[model samples]
Target: MISCACPEFALDNNPDTRAAMERITAAEADLLAARAAFYPQLGVTVEYNRTNNPMYSFGNILNQGLFTNTIDFNDPGTTDAIQAKGVLQYRIYNGGRDAAAMDAAINREQASVFDNETVRLQLQANIVRAFCSIVQAEEVVTARQSALEAISASLAVAQARFEEGSLLKEEVLNLEVQQARAEERLIHARHCLSLAQRGFLRLLGLQGAAVQLDAQGSPAQEIPANPDINRRPELQAMAAQIRMLEAMVRQAEGGHAPTADLFGSYQVDRGAEFGDGSGNSWTTGIRLNYALFNGGRTGAEVERAKALLREAREKRQHLELACTLEMEQAVLALHQEEERLKVTAKMVTSARESARLSRLRFKEGLLLSSELIDTENRLTDAQLSHSLATASRTIAIADLRRAVGLPQFNHGK
Candidate 1:
């Protein structure tokens, strides 16, 4: 049996959880990329060209120190030049665009972390439900097996009485019919158990593995008197999303501010042969840019970002409402399942006692065969009901853990 007391048994291997982890990594990478704007950018290029294009040829000759009075101004003739150049640029100012972008990326990474927590919480709840199902199914199968054993025992006694000419053949035949039916019931219960086991295995990502479920029931859980889910991961995720959107709005607004950058370049050129021209030259300066007109694109982008921010805030509001509703619903469900379990436990006790008395009465010729069959069925049904009620209570507690954002459930005792 797989132990769900620790999430690593399933969580580290689950496909959904793995995908969430990847998303977290992706978000972190995006944050790193955003922060790159704070650093200098440098590029190097080396190229050799042979051309007679008027503009480039003249510039190349001047750069290579080959421009002389002897060369005809009208035609510089074909020339081959090799130039190696490096440029460096660093943004001096851009309002707060870079800072806002970095903030947005940080918030996005936070949102991804919360999202992964949400996935893990839901997965824990699902594992609990599946584990409960397997446990319940196993109990049901055992109950049916017991009922079948009781029926077979009664059938044997009836057969002996019929052979001794004391009991009617019809009575024996009725018992025989019920015995067969009880066997069918047992077979079906086992089938359900097998299916439940398979589902549990699938949840743990252990498909086609040999199945064996723990028959031990989960420990009783006390529903918190004032269960609150204000700190649920989903709500936190939405809040992070809203913050990220707010940063995007700020980033957009920064677009209207003029941008300034410091730039420098170094170049070396060769003409006719390598290293035959002006050895090296360097240029450095500060540049400024402002988009005086752009068909209203910048304004449109700012408006769009504001709109998205507004939408995200509204979504967060909706998420808060959802979290409240989920918490209330989970509490109510736990309460109901607890009461149901209590009732079913009493029912099983009463039915088991009744079945036992009926069996004694039938052997003593004080009860009809049909009445015995009815009592047997009632006992089996009560057993199944109690098992179902227990499983339901376990599942409800798991859901409460999920609603409240607990790391993982601890139903094991």
Candidate 2:
């Protein structure tokens, strides 16, 4: 018998799980970007304007003979102007648009968080399933190897009897054939074990990492009854989406409300000859603007927002139904697989004993070689069935955990 325990497989150390956790970091970046909208925006401008023929001569003509009548029309002078301003434009009041937008951004960030959580749960489920498969495959390899050894012993006995002219050549051939078949099964089981190992490694996101599986023990906990779906990330994400949609609706409605902003500006101008060669002036005031009408555009936008809200509500309902059905199915499958595993375990023991007795009887020249071969084949089938049943049960339990929003292989006793 193989003495190794089942392997310890958990998503806590998986690279995919780690990557999902990093999504929160990205969400934080988005939150920062959204908050920046409340800050002021600054702008600077520089201009070098040159006019070949200037209109300043008109003002000069009007001042003709007033002081000194001397028409000195030389090359038009170029005006080089540089202006810099620090603008502080904060929405003192907006039809609640800014608040709605900020709320929407916050909701979206929350949704991202839930999405990451859901991903972690999925990874955990996959890892548990793959790990269980590896264990089951290892058991199969061991069982097949044991059967091959038994068949080898029987074949040797048959050959010696044939050399002593007590057993026919046909009997020896039958035993050899059974031994070959056992060898084939062992080879196939080894291949299956290799495949399972690769699958486990891939699920852990350790594609190139050098790792070996250390079998632990069978899962100790049973599936929970009546899982709380409210804690599920999928449901939480849906809730966040609904909140985001509500924010969008409010933002659209805010478009119809009045917006207030405070503005101030200063300008400096220099003149060549007219009166007041240089002047500086500043003005500050509050402005209120409202979109009185826009050819039904704002009204259509509000309708569209409402339509989207309805769609989101419907989607949430559908998801709730789907989750409920999946949970039920997973629970049923787990029970079924558990029962099958128990039955197959019993079958393996009975078949092994029958094969051993048949081989011993054939060696005593009391049973036909054909009977021994039949028993050996039955033993192989029972071993394979038991292995498959165990693997299926493990997969079912992992799926049940996922359906109920529990961590993969939580197996918390």
Candidate 3:
């Protein structure tokens, strides 16, 4: 995990990150619902009826214990009845489908957690890239400003020589043109810096907020020699998926087995009055259900589940290989950038010394104006290249960290 204490670490504030978190919460709710399926269900029912049927009315009066000797047996009966009932049902067994479904739900929730972690890591990688861009832009602007100052000083020297009649007017004009070009480069660099800052803010989902980038250059940290790709969030998610598929296969196979349930109910019946004298009755029983035949539907479902399990295994194998390849490629790229940074650093030192000597020689009339201009241009190019190399190295390290599942930059260093 990245322990960076900078404002860039406000990753939870990002909408994508929050959305991923919500997915995990939803998966947890689904898991709870699945587990709840194992418990017994209880329900209540209330009913009222007014009837004038000879048989039904007589039966209702008997049930309520309200039958009287004065009632004529041959006459059609009338009944005003109210009943309240409570029922309890429990699944004794269901071909093991309930257990398998619960397992699948657990695995699904675990997979969602890994997926959420993957999203967080990806967001961290993006933030690192954006932060490095701002740093690169700043360096470029500083290099361009330095180059402009050098050219301006050269122009002043050329004008002074021209007035002393020691240098041609055309040479002074050439220096003036170089100064104009250098100024244009400085302006372009500043514009690029502004654009990069805007993009960084946008990535953080704080587009209108004023933010300052504090990174000066490449961050120093220990690079791991051997990283385990098995720890990657993507691989963890795939593993969870495989478990879920296996559980689903078990659930489908359970469809071929028999199911048993226990059920019980109690009722109170009142005649002619809502809450007056009443009679009560209760009953309990065990029921068994077996799917003797359903046109091979259960068989087809089992086959489909097995096929999905096979596909999930194959996909996991492919991703394992891909993860290995990605790790190797990222390591190679990081090494290349590290070497490039060193080469650019040396180039900047050599170019600066060469430019300094060229300027001294020009003042002593030992170097031509064109030679001096070439040295200055080489110095500017070297500075710019150094800046780019620094930024590239920083980004490469961030990429390597992500490939190894170390998503956040270590702010401790």
Candidate-wise lDDT, in order: 0.84, 0.73, 0.82
- Candidate numbers, best lDDT first, in rank order: 1, 3, 2
Better of 1 and 2 by lDDT: 1
Report the Cα lDDT for candidate 3: 0.82
Angstrom error at residue 129, model 1: 0.4
Reference-based TM-score, model 3: 0.90
Instruction: Name the regions of candidate 1 deviating beyond 4 angstroms.
Output: 1-8, 215-225, 273-275, 410-413
What lDDT score is found at residue 192 in candidate 1? 89
> Model 2: runs farther than 4 Å from truth?
1-26, 46-78, 208-211, 217-222, 266-281, 409-413
Error of 3 at 34 (Å): 1.2
lDDT per residue for candidate 2 within 98-129, as digits (tens), equals 77888888998899888887887787677667
- Clashing pairs in model 3, backbone N/Cα/C closer than 3 A: none
Model 1 TM-score relative to the real fold: 0.94
Give the least accurate 10-residue stretch of model 2, judged by summed lDDT: 59-68
Model 1: per-residue Cα lDDT over 1-413, one tens digit each = 45454334678777899999999999999999999999999999998888887677777778877767887766777767878999999998998999999999999999999999898888877877887887788888899889889999999889888888878999998999998988888899889888887877777878767665444433444455567876698888888888998999899999899999999999988777323655468999999999999999989999999999898888888887888888889888988999999999999999999999999999988888999999999999999999999889888887887787775434531
Q: Write model 3 residue lDDT over 114-146, tens digit each, in one string.
A: 988788777877777787787788888888898
Model 3, residue 165: displacement in angstroms? 3.0
Q: What TM-score fits each model?
A: 0.94, 0.84, 0.90
Minimal lDDT window, size 10, model 1: 213-222
